[model samples]
Target chain A: MQGVEQGVLDLDEDVNRYLDDSEVTVPETYEEPVTLRHLGTHTAGFESAIDPDVVADWDAIVPLETVLVDQMPPRVRPPGELVGYSNYGAALAGHIVAEAHDTTFEEYVQSEIFEPLNMTHSTFAQPVPDDSPGNIAAGHTRDGDGFQTVDTVYINMRPAGSMTATARDLAAFMRVHLGAGTVDNRRVLQTDTVRVMHDQHHVRHPAVTNWRYGFHEYGHPDAGVLGHSGATVHFSSHLVLVPASDVGIFVNYNSNSSEHPPPGTVIDEILAVCGLQSSSTEPTPTAQPGSRERAETVAGGYSLSSLPQSGPLQVIDVLEHVSVEPAAQNRLRTVTLAGNTRQWVETDPYVYHEVDGNDVLAFEVRDGEVERMYMASEPTGVYQPVPAHERQLVTGSILGVSLAGFGLSLAGWGRQCARQTWKQYRTETDSVTEGEHTE
Target chain B: MTDHSESIHSQQSGHPAEHIESDERTRSLTWLARVAGVTLSTVSLGFVLLLLVVIESGGELTLITRPFLMQVVLTLPYLIGFLTVGTTAGAVLAWWHRYWSRRVRIHHTLLAVLGLGFSWQLVRLGFITL
Candidate 1:
């Protein structure tokens, strides 16, 4: 965005135009070039593995260009089609920013965005550089009995995840976005640029959650709640900007334990105490006519489009299939392999609201068949129908049956080997006695 | 005695332990066949069982979401390919060799066949590429 404000990069221009080498490997069939806007909106259609294969050891980390060219994930879908949250796309956009300024991405951001915003504690440098102020928090994992401290791994694609900052600094950053790129009378961005960014860039559906330039619509669609959530294996952070209320919140946690409350929980309480969020009393509307019939139309297994559509990680899609089952009284139940069950009630045609929650389940129906399903809270990606063969029941059954066959065969082989050994021993003993008598 | 000892050593070295347990088992299978069979039964099964343990313990849904476990899962195909090829050859040898009892022969053949079928399941599940 800083690059866009300075005219160093154009939002609509193809990202490949900024690359001196290592262009994004779009499929031969896909003619549409992935633009900077697509990267920002996460509509670049990259079917990447959840991991970009970041290096574990800091020393093993390579240059961004090397990872981009050598380990570039294949583009399996057409650009501007699906909203698949992509770290690679974010990293690519950062690379373009660096290229435009003839400097490293870290240096460019340091000079342009971070320093100007006075985010002194944040740095893209790996290991946070020895001299940087403030100690980095150690992340933790939930062990059997308690939490165990874990090392923070290096993110090779620095632009994607490598940043060390406190909630205070992030709140300062958020204030700028909320204050129209001005915080404390220091203008960090042009008013128009800020307005353009806050506006919806790409929308999955007007009725469902949509993506702004970088933030996803959260809470209520019109509550003006836009937030971006970031997580690694151990640590998770969430930043929300309620532009309408001129309120913003930033929460960072060092642990992602099930016992630990989600960042949203903290944010919600803060919002509630401040008299901002009053969603608890929002009365549930009466079920619209034809709700059950509409629910039946969208019932089936769905795979998140953000998940890998090809490669070994594709099995993750198989294991994590989300099934939508029609329930009693025009309610729909969404069940996940993770064993989460969310019930939604239809309040509008093809649009369902959580029975007692804030999330919305809106489906796009075409020709009486569901084409896409959108969850308001999961603004990063949308779900598409899973094919019959890829469904969990089918794959899980095959795996179970196969294991049984191998196990039974193995047991039989063991029995046969044991029986043969005993018989051979007896035969040898009898032959030895007969030979002794002859001698 | 020296010549006799040399002859014995020569025989031992020249032929594999022959019984189904040793080279004499050459009548049934070679050492390669044993290793492949053991790996197909134990190694592959061990991995799947470990996966099941992880899943039953609530790792199934979270496995895909976590990057570390996924890195381990994606590396299985390269390692499992050896078993796939070996089991294929082992199945062929079990069918061709006629020395063992009918049941034993069928046991080896059945294991090989089942192992191949398990590999197919892995492929269908997208763990192994077709």
Candidate 2:
């Protein structure tokens, strides 16, 4: 974005033009080339893959271009088709910025974004650069009935998930974005550029959450809230900027566990303490006529597109299905395999709003069926329809029956062997009895 | 396997026809059932064992980081498919020839039906694009 502000790069220009050592070629299936704009909005047509090419060891980490070029994900969809979150796209954008300035990504961010905002302790360098101030937070995951500290997973895609910073630093960064490109009169970005970045760049629908240049709409489109969430293995953080109120809230968690409330609920608690607009204070949204019919039409299983579809991790898709079921009185309930359920009221033709919360669920319908759905809470990815064969009802039954077959077969063979042994023993006893009679 | 081609000594011993009929399972189907059953059982058991390992070790995110491990995991579906086909063929032969008792025949047919169902799921998931 700084590169764009300086006229060093164009948002609509071919991203490959800026690269010297590597390129993002348009796959043979796709005729449209990807651009920086596409990357920023996460609509670059790359297949959704979560693995960011983590290195086995610190010494194995290479330059960003080497990893990007070697592991460039195949463009499985046309550019601008739909948003599939891409770590590769984010890293590629970072590389383009570095290329524009003739410097490394970590150095460029340290000098430009971090230094200008006075976030002195923040650093993108992994193993945290020796001179970097502040102790890095340790990560933890669930163990048997307890939590255990684990080593942080390292990745070569430094620009995507390698940032290490304190909560204070994150607040300052959010304030800078919310301040419309200034902190105490120190202008890091022009006001117009901030507007362009914070405003909707790629909108799915007016009623649903849309993607700003880098941030995603949070809570609701009308709530004047935008956020970007980050997580790697056992660590998680969320930064929300309520631009209209000039209020920014940042939350960080050292451990990624379901025991903690989601970031939104935490933000809601803070807002309530602050006497700001919480979900309860908001007026109830009325449902449009014919809500029950629309709910029935869209009721089915959906798969998260962010999970890999062509890898061993494909099994994860089966476990991640979300089902929408019709509820009483013009409402719908979404249930996930993970057991998180949310109630939604149909407020528009295919748009639904959360019952108590402001999360928006907007569906794109074609031929009277849901094409895809975007929920404000899950900004990382959208949901696509899961086919009938792959649904749990079908797959689970097959798995159950096959396992039963294996068991019954073993039992049958065991029974046959037992009968033969009994026959042999009885025959031997009869022979022994006849010999005694002869004697 | 103890097939219906009862040994000459057992026949001479005057074992009834029903006794021979009860032991009519073929060596080929027996071997097929063993391979398919064991392979499927191993996978089901491995899933439980892997859950224990993950829970006991906290988590193993490194599995995703290494390409070698991912490549090995990617082959599992195909391995299951290959064994499924073998099981299906064995089941069909067992049913057509009444190769074993009614109980065993019914069990083999059920296994075939389940194998087809699972294979269809694999195809839907694109693990078996062909």
Candidate 3:
């Protein structure tokens, strides 16, 4: 984004112009060339790509070019068609940044962002640099019976999720954003660029979740929150900044065990402790009767656009589960991303509020049809309704055929047993009759 | 002496009649065995279809990240069950053809081919990239 501010790169320019076509050729699935703006905002409709080797082998590190080439997920949908959060897209942006600056992505970020902000502890290096201060937190994951310490899994797409940093370094990084791109006497990003990043640029749907340059919006622009969250196999972290209050909170947990509270809830608690209240007013929306019929349209299954739907990992897409149904008094009952059941009160014709009345859910309609849904608290707010055929065709066939085959085979076995028994009985009677005749 | 000779002749005639009747019964049993083989094969084919659809629709498309090891672990039960069903069905059909009827029918061959093919595909889907 600083590149955009300094005229070193254009946000709306075709990203392919910067990337080496041999190493990274994003298929032009749609006529609209993917722009840097789309990449940063996560509106580029690229499928999620996660190589299985990276998770299992900690030492199996690959170059970013190889990771990009091998795991170049297909552009399944048209560009800007929907907001699908993609790690691959973010990494692609990092690649573009490296290309524009004529240096490696790590070097660029180190010299530009980290050095400028004085975040001495943060480094994108896979093998944590030796000179870095403080011991890197040892990640832990649950074994069969107990937690086992593990090394940080090396991310092949390092730019997307591999950065390691301390809380102090993060505070320094946040201070720059809170200071409107200025920290002390240094300026990493111009105030105009920072304003562009915080301003709502692309919205998945109207009155739904608003997305800034790379940040997710949590409330109205006047009293909104902007931040990003990340998780690895054994580590979870979140960072949230409220520009209105000039305060940012960050939390990083070393274990992936469920015993730890979610990072979102922890941040919320921290904000509450800080006595930072949202200045936005809640709208009391009247309930529309079921006669509207449009309400029923939103009642179906939706899946995170960020989830993979191609290659081996596509199975996650099938398993990704969320459902919305009309509840009592026109309220909506939804299974949240956290797998918890939550009730929502209708806030508008298609907008709904969490029963707690904090999070928002808005359905996007195009041409009188519900096209997508945006939830304020979801990881990737834009959710496409799961096609009915995908749900019914495969599941229904498996269950129906299995049960039918079981009944048929059981009946055949019974018939065979009865016939064998009858034959044996008749043979015994015949032999007895023969003995009587001989006597 | 005449009455004894007549009794011997009647016994000889009765023996041939009994042998013919037994042959008929054996033939009927062979026919029944063949029918059972066909039924088992058809049922097994249905099971194979179900398994294939499941892998196509769910397994291949939705695995999360690089957790292939975990995927294999979770899918082991289904893989084992599939193999068990296919092998058992194939064995029953093969036994009927080789030991009981001593004749292999088209349906029996179909079942063997389908069972083996499905088992191969199932293992591939579970353990490796499909």
Candidate 4:
């Protein structure tokens, strides 16, 4: 918002112009240019670039530039082609914002967003500030025995999800969006610019609502809601704004678990209690007979579009499987790497809708085969089916060879042990006989 | 004549005794090498297998997420090194056994090779992490 207001950035301008060679080198495999608008709308065509270690240790916070360069997930499809949620792209935007301001991203957000809104309790610092206004909540994960407290994760892409804020501080920040970029007559963002930010930037699928600048659109326009949810290894947070009522709610959780109601659900429950229509009125489309064929063409294993296609880490392709399996009633079930299965109904020829949610998955078919798929979950556009070499077949071969090798080795060891014992016995018997002869 | 004959026979027996003792010492050292070589190779192979299983299991190694290749790049070196070292050790042990030991054992060499091979599958099964 600051960059747009200062005229340092043009939403339609190609983001590559602002990024220097040292900062970021977004590979351009296609003619389409990735603009600031694409990044904001989560249609940058980049896949999910996740490092499990990002927040594994808060002490090991890495430089943003390093993460940008090292974790640059491949752009598998052209920009503006699909809406795939990308933390990397969001962080890249933050980088661009910092570069425009001539300061660190953390420092810039602190001085700009935090200071302007008087969010004294909020800090973007990795490992978070020790002297913040409120007590930092500990995050947790459950194991076989019980829930275990997990340390706060600090990703190099801090701008994406590293901000630590108290409920009180968030309330102040929420007021700005609720108040149309101002609170108590203090302008954090110009009214016009906030209008543009709040406007529909991209529609993920026909059935679901569109994506605004930095927020996800939910529910009908009559009872619409704009919000964003974030989760680290330990903590989860959601900030929802109901523009009609001029009401905003901010919620935060100390622990992370599958058992916990997702922040979206909490927002819905809150809206219900407030007598608002929290349920989405998605227009379900008529089923196309060829929808099954189109879905089948795209139904296969898809590696992350954001991962390295070449080099050693390309092996991570296996860990990033997003299988699009066809289910009953022309619906598609997408089983993600984390083992979370989401049911998607075909709302259009090649578009899928999350059963009762706003999530969308759209596929691009060419020459009777699936060429690309853009998911609404995060900015990830998966292009090209996972090659045979990178699939489970290769893994099976490696396992088979390794097994054969181990079996042979173990058998050899057993035989050697028996031989050694037999030789020892023979040597002792020979020695005894020799002693008797000498006597 | 009897004294002379006994002396000659004693010297002949003494020469064979010296040769046998020398062979026994060489065989003892070779046996020790065989033991060290097989044991070290086996242990190395075990670790290599763990690394493989970890990669295959996507860091889980259980009935959870499908064991697709996890961070397999981090594991290749250990697997390759295990195989190379085990094979080299086997070759050296076989050569040593043939040249020095009175009783040649093929099991020592096979043990090394098989140990490394077993480790690869262990990795696929996800019992370990690299």
Which DockQ values do the candidates obtain, in the order shown? 0.26, 0.28, 0.07, 0.09
RMSD of 4: 9.1
Q: Residue-wise lDDT of candidate 2 within A1-439, one digit each (tens)?
A: 7788889999998787888654534345566778999998898888877777665477878888888878888888887777889999999899888888989899999899899889998988877777777677788766678877777668887688788899888887887788888988888899899999987878766777789999888765677778888877667777888887788898888887354675667876776676555454333445456777788999999987677776545667788888889988768899977788988877668887787776788888999978898887677778998878678788778767766666666666678889999999999999999999999
User: Residue by residue across B1-130, what tens digits does model 4's lDDT show?
Assistant: 9989977987777667777997897677666655555555555555556555764433321111123333443444455445546555645755755753433445455544544444443443333335
**How many residue pairs collide in each prediction?**
10, 0, 8, 18
lDDT of 3 by residue, B46-114 (tens): 544554655554333223332444444445435434544554555474566453433344434444444
- Which wins on DockQ, candidate 1 or candidate 2? 2
Candidate 1: stretches off by over 4 Å: A21-29, A257-261, A272-275, A278-289, A310-312, A433-439, B1-38, B49-82, B85-117, B124-126
Chain B only, TM-score of each candidate = 0.60, 0.58, 0.33, 0.32
Per-model TM values vs. the true structure: 0.85, 0.85, 0.73, 0.69
Give the TM-score of chain B in candidate 1.
0.60
* Overall lDDT per candidate, in order of appearance: 0.76, 0.75, 0.69, 0.67
Candidate 3 lDDT by residue in tens digits, A1-439: 8888778789888888887643787887889999988887888878755432344355677767788888777787777677778888888888888888888889999999898888888899878877888898897766667777865567777687788988988998898889988888898888888898888778676666667888877543334788788777677888999888889998888876253776877887777677664533445655566523655778888877876655435445555557788877667888644668988777677887777546778887777777888887763647888876554234435435544544555566578799999999999999999999999
RMSD (CA, Å), candidate 2 to true, equals 6.3
- In the range A340-418, model 4's lDDT, one tens digit per residue, is 7988877778877778765667776778877667665543334447765455556656645555555566677689789
Instruction: Give the Å error, residue A288, model 1.
Output: 5.8
For model 1, the DockQ equals 0.26
Error of 4 at A31 (Å): 6.1
Candidate 3 local Cα displacement, residue A322, angstroms: 1.8
